[model samples]
Target: MDNPQRNDNPWFMALYIGGAGGILATYILIGFFAARWLVGMVEGPRYWIAIGTISGLVLGSFHIVMLIKKMMGEQDG
Candidate 1:
């Protein structure tokens, strides 16, 4: 049987890379914008952006981890 992970398909690899990157960037952008909007409404401490960015990073990392886990499971199962 042909192993699913053994195939070094460039296009498939590119797709995964693009998807992971897009997902991470999108999450970060969304967090930034959401925080920016919140800041606009309330004037106080300006650390919301940092919180949003960190939140985005954490969520994005979680998504990537889940994605990799699923892919690996598919290959090994």
Candidate 2:
């Protein structure tokens, strides 16, 4: 029998993989702006941007991990 969790169409997998870049970029941008807003650092040695980028990296990693797990049908109920 065909697996139910996976998509029957193979092209959809490519779509997901391609979309990963957009997702990661979006997460990073959001984190960066959020940090800027929270810290109110418009200029002059803004360290918050670094912090935000790192935070975004971490969050994005988690999101990517979850996405991979879901795509692989390893998601736990």
Pick the TM-score winner: 1
Candidate 2 lDDT, 29-70, residue by residue in tens: 988888888677566457887898889978987898888887
Top lDDT prediction, candidate number: 1
In model 2, state the lDDT of residue 52.
89
lDDT of 1 by residue, 1-77 (tens): 56655546799878987899999998888888888778888964579988887788889989988987776566544
What is the alpha-carbon RMSD of candidate 2 to the true structure? 3.3
Measured over all alpha carbons after superposition, the RMSD of each candidate to the real structure, in angstroms, is: 2.7, 3.3
Task: Give TM per candidate.
Answer: 0.78, 0.77
- State the C-alpha lDDT per candidate: 0.81, 0.80
